[model samples]
Target: MAIDRQTVNRVAFLARLKIDDDKIEATEEEFNKILNWVEQLNEVNTDEVEPLSAVNDLPLICREDNVTEGSQADKILANAPMAEYGYFVVPKVVE
Candidate 1:
């Protein structure tokens, strides 16, 4: 599809841009060129190309999931101003 002056004006309005009267033609031409270039992408053959998230195919390192973060209550509670129940003590926020 070709871009017209109305399309250029609409795009400029939506994008919050102020295009002068003398520049509208230039802006429309540039927009048409961009649209034409994008239309050329449709001619490329991607039938055999597989969709991938990344270009690299690195194997992820798998590890056994286990609970190993414990036995540090005293070490962690040392930084709290008040720790009666092994947790950070903060001012009551509710009325």
Candidate 2:
């Protein structure tokens, strides 16, 4: 698809880009080249190709689920900028 000067200006406006009048021509040419490349990709045949997540497949390492609570109430509270009574304190937002 060939993008003209007007389409390029509209695209720039929609994208919130500030492009000078001189740069619009170059931007239109660049956009046309990119669209041409995408059009070329539509010509390729991929009937037998299987979609793949990764080129190499490897099983993830398995580990047993373990849960244990640790006592660090005072240590964690010490790192907070404003903590009150073993909890983090924050500024009031609701009126």
TM-score per model over all chains: 0.48, 0.46
Shift of residue 31 alpha carbon in model 2, Å? 0.8
Which residue segments of model 1 deviate by more than 4 Å?
A: 46-95
List clashing residue pairs in candidate 1. Answer: none
Candidate 2 similarity to native, TM-score: 0.46
lDDT of 1: 0.90
Candidate 1 residue-wise lDDT, 1-95, digit = tens: 88999999999999999999999999999998999989997898989988778788999888789886889989989878888877788889798
Which digits, one per residue and each the tens of the lDDT, describe model 2 over residues 1-95? 77999998888889999999888888888999999989987787878878778877988788778766558888888878999888889998698
Best by TM-score, which number?
1
Error of 1 at 38 (Å): 1.5
